[model samples]
Target chain A: MSASDPAGAAAGAPAVAIEQLRKSYGPITALDGASISVDTGEIFGLVGPNGAGKTTLIKAICGILKPDSGSVSVLGLDAARERHAVRRRLGYMPQTPALYEDLSPRENLVFFGRGFRTSGLSDRIRDVLEFVELWERRDDPLHNFSGGMKQRASLACALLRDPELLILDEPTAGVDPTLKQNFWRRFRELKERGRTIFVTTNMMDEALHCDRVAVIRAGSVLITETPEAIRARGRTRVTLGLRDGSLREQEVLAYEEEMPRLLAAYGLSDEVARISVRRPSLEDVVLGMIAGDAGAGEKPAHGGAHGGAHGGRTTGAHPGAGADAEDGGNV
Target chain B: MFSNINAIAVRINRQFLRDRRFLGLSLIVPVLLMLLLKYVLDSLPGLARLGVHISDYAILVAAYLVHFLAYVLSTIVLVRDRKDGTLGRMFVYGYRRREIVLGYVGGYSTIAAVQTALVLILTKYLFDINLAPDLIAVVLTMLALAVVSVGLGVFISNFARNEGQVFPFIPLVIVPTALLSGIAIPIDELPRVLQWCSYLIPLRYAVSVLDGVLNQHRSFFSELGPFLTLVAVGAGLLATASLTLRERE
Candidate 1:
């Protein structure tokens, strides 16, 4: 509720922490003993495939879903026991923009602000609308707005309370590239203001923007590490052009050692013409991990705070998109 | 809690006001239904020879109109709200189940209030009933019925997942009230088992009380017994509704 709110939370507590959280819908398990932690003032991303419990985890963090077992702590308060108190400290934007289609941006702001009992109503509404570049569209109804415009309006409502922690579920799913960039810019700006952000996105490039991302599959976290560290673990592709104009490609976890060993085996240095190397992208690495684990029931290799072993490092490329390509799930 | 309720109420009222067509229809439908009811009731054989004017039954029609319309309107709106994720958004933003049910009841009360006033005034003018003497009790009874209808709507909505799912419930609720609530058949004349089940219908109490003042010429205070029962049912429905309303998917 104030500039000092994030700091006012239980001192030294992480923004979010979940331990062995499990949830089920009838016979289908949504979250299977998933554990993760998010530090304050950092942008954390949760990456997963469809029906992989990305949303269920987000809801647990927001205190909207009670885990079948285990615990969730938000801002140092128990998520289930202190749901109301937890809600007061955070803002949640659902996968879809949940604004009333009949109400204008300004009216929506007023409604949410009143719900939060926010102070300085007029000033707060103006500031949020302007922050989201929605001031010009203040009086326009949401149903009349374009998709990106509706998103902006929804974001403005979420920020009305000046929440210490903001949770966005696929905030840029259908957003154009330019607006997607715009949204990340706003998220970073909020980050600069010392607010913690928890975003769930499957887009590889979007995952790159986070301080760290946790790849989840079948309700368990396959790995949690910095993008750079995870990227270092994937194999690099090497393409070779021979004197006869034939091109050969090879993938290696360590190109420095493997490339030379490969060339020596060919026994024809004079025949080598050209060479190019391409490292596996985050998407390729993620899909490889998920595929590797989906049918094998194999435990993901141990990973340290920096980077260690993760089983998702395998072969396969997503069709249509380049290895490193991003998808906004365009509308 | 009060402020949260007020915020939700204001937002809903704004939406109601903006859709002028829906608002106009809400007020007009009861009047049209009243005329239709009279047309059909007038056709019942031997009523005119028995010296009972068909218009004399307008009070019963008014009570049913309030119950049916209020229940249908509230149920549909709540189902739509849940489908749109606004209900989930509110829960994440700290709105409790009780506050949500109360807030909606508060919001829809705008339409209910105006509709109550319109039906009572039209019942007096169109039916030629001597309602002036017991105006306060009669109006209170009608308004309480509207409130109870709204509560029942909220309760029933929890059983439906989407707008399409509310269809089966429309007949499931409306038909029982129409047949067993004493307007179609006198309550005492029904079998004892059926008579006991009529007590479960809120409209039965409203009809009993409304009949007392409009036709039986009973003093207003004498009708308080059934009126209190109606209020008790409303309170019970609202509380059960709050308890049943899901805070999570």
Candidate 2:
């Protein structure tokens, strides 16, 4: 495989590398020795809960926020001292919508395009707007656009100069699911075009799209691995669904040593379903780790944003539970 | 550097055209204030209890308008941009903090220069106010006033959290400067203590420079000390503003 090719699994030179990053906001530590590297053309995902220092880390790398101690290098340039050159090669979409709301989408794109000093900027603006599929509404006031459209426009503005690196913070948080799917497709297309991207998302399912995932908690990274690696290390998960749905709540309440036995007595066997509980999901893994849950086998309930069961096909059961055992709520 | 400057100018002008309130301040507010200045200067004979020509007040008003326009409008626009995150956004896009400051100066300076032209043209042609001895000196003084006003705007914007906080500071700077800068209340008649207080205002130096240039027709160098002093004050404020940007970083 060629050096520039992104398809190869082996890591080449990292496009962006950070080491021993430390930052603090008064008494609260924002990043504690957080380090990660994004290889050339790889679409990396930084996964973490809120206040997990994801933004802090991104800001430090972007030179907008300074870390108390650490080093960040982008494409082999110092992030702090060489910020302008680094910025020249990167497109950043902040968590908050940073476009001028009063300006039309076209005007906003042109404005940011000018900032990047892109040659044939007007044409580049047109191409980016079309790429984001927002060309038709280019003349619409940004304030009038819906959340998803506004996000697409923001993406367009960031892509005005087609920088090599893209840093997006929850780029699809408020976007509708259909548009989000489209966004992921666009991200893959950009990845194919040899652009490196570092994205932060709380959406667990989106983790599957990333080449690698770094799960962070509090002010430190919990783990970083490929999606398959994370899933392969996944412990047993037996999501019990009761006919009445009331017994499941009580079973969760009596969840110490008794819940497992109760689950097994009802034919919820380990050989069949990999019982004895397991390490929680990406979200639970971080929260449980924060709560000092020891990463041991514990069937922590999944909540927050994933209220749906089975890919939007909703069922009247506790969230994320897949099993249906009716005889006095098997497990 | 120039390309960066062009980018900043585009953003500033885009903002100027898009925000209705800013547009009004840039175009209409200055014209209206010119008329108001004409009226107030016309009424000064009766109000001041001193025999002062509307023409004399007109010269002072021309100079003061430069100050007023620079202070009021620059404060509003700069403060709005800061509160709305435009200043922070500017830094993210390869712009030096100094470039942002100077680009705003360049954009607002263009606005002030054009408005100064109209005010002077109206005062000379429409109002029949005779030309002063040193027209270039007067123009340079007005330019200095513009610089001082914009510098003060950037300085004040650093402290203002939002548009609401910015509004209250307008009176804090404008009221005292107007009263003491020989615009309304002549500085000579005020007590010695208040006279010293007036000296602290950058506009006081601006008005003195204009007074020497237009009223006395002195060479610009005759009033060079105060002119350069005002420039220094403006530069000091701008430097402070650039330093405070570290907080945002």
Best lDDT goes to which candidate?
1
B136-164, model 2: which lDDT tens digit per residue? 77677778778778878877777777778
Against the true chain A, what TM-score does chain A of candidate 2 give? 0.71
Worst 10 residues of 1 chain A by lDDT: A314-323
What is the DockQ for all candidates, taken in turn? 0.67, 0.46
Off by over 4 Å in 2: A1-13, A25-29, A139-141, A226-331, B37-49, B121-128, B132-135, B184-200, B217-221, B228-248
Candidate 2 accuracy as lDDT: 0.71
- Model 1, B60-110: lDDT tens per residue? 878898899999999999999898888888888767888888899999877
lDDT (tens digit, per residue) of candidate 2 on A1-331: 0113333223466888889899999899999998898888888989888899988988876778777999998877788888777778788887766788888888877766666566787778788889998889888888888888888988886677676788888898887655765777778778877888899987766665678889888878888887545544533333567776744434243223344465776776655432232223433344446557665214422322222211221112232232111211100
Model 1 chain B: which ten-residue window has the lowest total lDDT? B36-45
Best by the TM-score measure: 1
